[model samples]
Target: MQTTSTYKILVVDDDPDIVEMLHYNLTREGYHVAQAGNGKTAIEEAQAFKPDIILLDVMMPVLDGIAACRQLRDISEFRHTHIIFLTARSEEFSEVAAFEAGADDFLTKPIKPRALLSRLAAFKRRDAQQDEISNVIEIAGLRIDRTSFAVYKGDSKITLPKKEFELLSFLAATPNKVFSREELLHNIWGSDVYVIARTVDVHIRKVREKIGEENIRTIKGVGYKFNTD
Candidate 1:
């Protein structure tokens, strides 16, 4: 199928080769590209570039992607930006860790450009649909009532599923902090059942989409935490 490139993507990592490789492939595909070699720079570039999507690395110096995701989440201007983690680690906990960091999705190393593009395509569709959803969490807009099985973005009502609301409430209970998938599993889903941590990622993506609010920050290699500030 023929497609037009309308998305601006930000690629952040400490590895120059990865940056170069992605930049070349993405640009060749007709999407605009931006790069940063470290976490702080990733935040800076994201702010300046105003990309439609971000491909963030898990490990970096002077503010790993997880921390920067926390900060980027605070800025209202970049609220709608979609974030996906680009990591070299692919263990049971690895994916869960990225989700805890607020990542929308994850991709392992030995870069597969085709797979990357396809994933971005799905993200684009999901991202477009997210614009109309209202995921307003609140504490009078300060406290997201992940409790009461509800979310109020300063008095506005944002509906969510039972599971989604539970997860949000748990994460929001502690804003701007990280939570590993294991912790979330035990807390949100309970530890007694058998499940993959990636289930958290599925729920997180759903939560973000439904809220229509973009404040959850993904910390690449870690887990997720809510950010209200």
Candidate 2:
């Protein structure tokens, strides 16, 4: 459903040179590209352009990338838009923070143009494959819609950011089946990602906060399972 020609991307950074370089590379790859010099302008451009992906710089003026990412995550319209934090910082804490703020991926600065192209291509392929799969899963008292990226509890809709929703949906897809943390990290975060295995706990806690803790049961020294029984 997503063609390279129609795929839109927004590159947000404080440096005009970086923005221009990114714009050039992305456009050359057949993507419609937009540029924003700050997080605030990035938000405005995102709202207006409705880009499918956003390459966000971590350090910026007016508003920082982490804050902007959190803000965007709160809005349902940007729920499924892929966000990758592009930063010079390679610290583990920085990566964890980005994920907590709702980034889909993190890329270190000075990224090779070829690497960026490969990553974007992979995402596009995954998205296309996802479209062919069932987007709605209904069980217990919840309805998870992958297409609209929404979750409904009975008649009320409960808003969850991207990662939380994906984790919940993955668990609910196989009710009562326990999944280990390593398995979760591999499946949800992708095996190539460098997130700590313990990061799963943070996301799990957030999911429990939104939904009832009773729904997701944790096994000591094991993993977690969706209790539909």
Best-fitting candidate, scored by TM-score: 2
lDDT score of model 2?
Answer: 0.85
128: Cα error in model 1, Å: 3.8
Model 1 C-alpha RMSD to native = 10.6
RMSD of 2: 2.0
lDDT of 1: 0.71
The best candidate in terms of lDDT: 2
Q: What is the TM-score of each candidate against the true structure?
A: 0.59, 0.91
lDDT of each: 0.71, 0.85
TM-score for candidate 1, please give it: 0.59
